[model samples]
Target: MSVETDSHGRLYLSSELRQKYGEKFHIVEYEDRLELVPIDEDPLQAVREAAGDAFEGESIEELRERAREQAKEDAEAGFERGKRTAEGGNE
Candidate 1:
């Protein structure tokens, strides 16, 4: 569908579109075009729905510790890879 912005640069969505999506949108710019991404009205609720069972059996502190450990491991692995690259080693 084609949409045009007004003099004030406000692109109005149709009532049907607004009802399907939400009132807010994020405009993403790419090399050839722009895309409108709908924003969730309740972002936290959206995250909860998206996560589903991923975080089901973990407490907040437990999750935080797990994330920290994973991040540390990732950083160490990246450092090892960089070190190998600097030493002219191919992986």
Candidate 2:
């Protein structure tokens, strides 16, 4: 469908289109053209759907603890490597 903007630079959509896709839209600009993407009314639900099984069986606290432990291990490993280099030992 063809659409034109008014003097105020606002593009009006038909009632049919609005009913089908809701009132909110995200304007996507490409090199040659612009496209309108409908925005989901519930953003949190969209994120939960996109994440799928990422959290699976683990609680938030468990995930945080795992991340902290991994960071600690990585830091210790890096310190050991730096110490070895400082001592002029072969890696």
Candidate 1 per-residue C-alpha lDDT over 1-91 given as tens digits, one digit per residue, 9 for 90 to 100: 8889899998988999999998998999999999989999998568768999787877779988998999999999999999999999974
State the weakest 10-residue window (summed lDDT) of model 1: 40-49
Give the number of colliding residue pairs in candidate 1: 0
Cα lDDT computed for each candidate against the true fold? 0.90, 0.89
In order of appearance, the predictions have TM-scores of: 0.76, 0.55
lDDT tens digits, residues 1-91, model 2? 8899999999999999999998999999999999999998997567657899776777768978998999999999999999999999976
In terms of lDDT, model 2 sits at: 0.89
Query: Which whole-number lDDT from 0 to 100 does residue 5 have in model 2?
Result: 94
The residue pairs in collision within model 2 are: none
Q: Which stretches of candidate 1 lie over 4 Å from their true place?
A: 57-65
Model 2 ranges off by over 4 Å: 50-91
